[model samples]
Target: MAVKTVKILTDDIDGTEADETVAFSLDGKDYEMELSSDNAAALRNVLAPYVEKARRVTQPARTSAKPASRGKSESGLDIPAVRAWARSNGWPNLSDRGRIPREIQEAYIAAGN
Candidate 1:
């Protein structure tokens, strides 16, 4: 039998919350999972740094709006709500230059336009 492998884009690179267990690719592609888990440690290894960065970006444990570790506000658009929104709507590609998340949230802050 062939070692099954899956082609997950890794949410961190795609800019979402932490790593998500992908049952299948977003485009509905089939995966030949090599490990018992859908996305294994080896797979996560390649994406660990990005995942850590994203994890720190939207730390669910955080409850207050504070400056990001990267030196920017934590989505001025209501941290918790924006975190949920980003998770739901897909964390869009924004500049990770500390300003990106805030910039993206600015739209939400100014919503109803």
Candidate 2:
């Protein structure tokens, strides 16, 4: 299953702020994480590549016939690249699943990731 979105919940419980425990959802499954501010920054640093890659979609230069097979929507990105892009953007669970769904493929292609 391809992940649709990532939802992060950072509300403190019982009005206590002792090392926040953030709750987030990936593909509908919920998980919690507790980390220091430094760790959160580190995590954002780790995810920067994926986020940037998704934000910037450049069509590869082709000098010969038979360019990379574009998707139905013609996103110009191959399937592997799409999957990797998704995984890098907080879709780690996709590794266990085979063949990204049509909706996800469409979104990935549409987003030019």
Candidate 3:
């Protein structure tokens, strides 16, 4: 089966009765489809399942081993302490928003007890 994609653009003009013009390109051809509010809602309903499926396919599966090791490594400091120390020294990218990055972790370990 061939994979097909739809690209859409929307422009809204202020104080207009029909404010939205949805321009979409399909099969290398461009066209504008005007939709009422109700139709737009219906289109969203139809596309919701495919959009969700695409999201699932794009995400990777996680393994049990990674989270376990990330909790605490062979290094003396646990993850939180390493993050704190990194911040105190004015280290770049100190936040543990995701996992503490590898370079910061290496710097922390290199500093030693």
Q: Judged by lDDT, which candidate is best?
A: 3
Candidate 1 runs further than 4 Å off: 1-76, 92-100
lDDT-better candidate, 2 vs 3: 3
Tens digit of per-residue lDDT, candidate 2, span 6-108: 5554433333233556554556588877655655566668777877776444568877775544442254447677787778776677753455767777777
TM-score of each: 0.23, 0.28, 0.33
Error of 2 at 28 (Å): 38
- Candidate 3 lDDT score at position 57: 28
Sort the predicted structures by lDDT, highest score first: 3, 2, 1
lDDT of each: 0.49, 0.61, 0.64
1 against 3, candidate with superior lDDT: 3
Candidate 2 deviant stretches above 4 angstroms: 1-77
Q: Candidate 2 deviates by what RMSD?
A: 19.8
Among all candidates shown, the one with the greatest TM-score: 3
What does the lDDT come to for candidate 2?
0.61
lDDT of 3 at 18: 41
Answer with 1 or 3, whichever has the higher TM-score.
3
Please give the TM-score that candidate 2 achieves against the real structure.
0.28
